[model samples]
Target: MVNQNNSAQSVEKTPSVDDKNLMNIAQYLKGVQQSHKRSIPPLDQWHPKHCGKMDLTVKANGEWWHEGQLIKRQALLDLFSSVLWKEEGKFYLKTPVEQIEIEVEDEPLLVSQVDQVDIDGKLYLQLTTTNQDVVVVDDQHPIFMRDYAGERRPYVHVRFGINALIQRHVFYHLVELGELDETEQGKAILVLKSGDLLLQLDS
Candidate 1:
């Protein structure tokens, strides 16, 4: 996992009423409103054939079909997860942060971020403030989910702050998954059949 050097002390600062007021104003300006544009057709309304089958195979040396085209290894990773592992390794689905113990200076840090699981099981990324206040990043926010179309699918989104900690949790699972592969170049990719596309950790 990469080390994030931001001071843990920053988590101890308290926000003033002025700060709270500004945050409220921001939310008021940005909260979701009824759009004048045409509404998206319901997922159930779509024909079964239009909704692609959920495929979970690891394609290290094989090809995976995407949008009616056969995409090979590197291209598949780029298209799906937007991440390229330096070495061929398995990646696993991460466990929720609430299940782990996170501490700073021997004191347990309050969980300021909440875990969000979409219907499909993909995790959403989130951050928190020092006051133990939760800040749910808008799914439409550029830094949160990228592909809105992908997000519409069945998937889960879990939120957590502290990038390094999140990476640690993810990589820990990756390593565990790596142990299950028979080939050295074989890799595992978490596929969200339906969910948000943005890689928040990259942001």
Candidate 2:
């Protein structure tokens, strides 16, 4: 759960760039976090009124920044990440009463680690995100290649329509676990297996 920041004071305003309004929004989000029971809030079910855009930006390297300063609190990052919502190709920090858009330079999240887990003698690849989201690699959380930053990169599906970029070291680890297979067209493809699913790691 995210503790309230010193920036968020109890003052309400119609959504704008005002620092007071931003504070109110953050305060409301903190309240929502305190009241929620699940590890991840049910952002799918939330239909908050559009509260305009915030200056918050998720950088390409997975750092969160608001205004011009870096958001350095891990708890706050976790809190905001819990309520992250993507719709129609846009991303927002959503709560029960309001939704504020945030800029995403690349993918909204990052896969910081990957582990191979054995379940009943079957091996599965599990990915852990920067926000501590653990997701098993399978059809539900498939890994696919996409063009990003002028290069082909592997991205995995996180929850709620959010996808995470596999970090360079993590991708190196994945390459060590994958096998190269040739398609019917005779092109080599690197793939990782999790249970019965085969995930492509290259384009």
Candidate 3:
């Protein structure tokens, strides 16, 4: 009887591990989806703001300006590295180390390559690419730079640079993979064809 009870307990514990693993997999997939969405910026509309010009050689000494209002360069770089934009051409940052690279085709795309394992101890497919671009603009405007006696403190503005073409590409890929169900609105949820969902969870 004791042996039988021990066996039952072991079986129960097995599923608990599996459940925990599934939850973890779900969270990882969710994170990847969110990151992909964030890398692209909206470029469908444009608004203009007024900016002041100043001489770089002269410092705005005795000028009463707000402190801690300036955006740090590292912050801007971090923003740009995560988000996609287009200035001269298509640009984006690859994850892990956030290496910036540009897509050269007529239609640019951002590729995210990830390695995932399955619950069955087998490897599976989770590799995919998304279309995106990086928008680069000169921060010559004094409003972007504090203490604007103009020291060539060029600021790089980062934002989404998505268009109809890229949007269609995303839509089509999801549809082609049969991952698109009418269940969600404004977003695509992919059903991965490879890799055990449970293994991915543990990973």
Model 1 ranges with Cα > 4 A deviation: 1-114, 117-184, 191-195, 198-203
Query: After superposing candidate 2, which stretches have Cα over 4 Å from the reference?
Result: 1-18, 32-38, 182-188
- What's the C-alpha lDDT at position 112 in model 3? 28
For residues 71-175, write the lDDT of model 1, one tens digit per residue: 354422322221111111222111111011111211111222334445446554343322222333345422211222233111122222221122224333423
The lDDT values for all models are 0.27, 0.81, 0.30
Error of 1 at 38 (Å): 36
The weakest ten consecutive residues by lDDT in model 1 span 93-102
Q: lDDT tens string, model 3, 153-189?
A: 2121223442211233433443354353333344423
**Structural similarity to truth (TM-score) of each candidate:** 0.18, 0.83, 0.18
- Kindly list the per-residue Cα lDDT of model 2 for residues 18-51, writing each as its tens digit: 3544576568667766553437877788788998
How should the candidates be ordered by lDDT, best one leading?
Answer: 2, 3, 1
Error of 1 at 33 (Å): 29
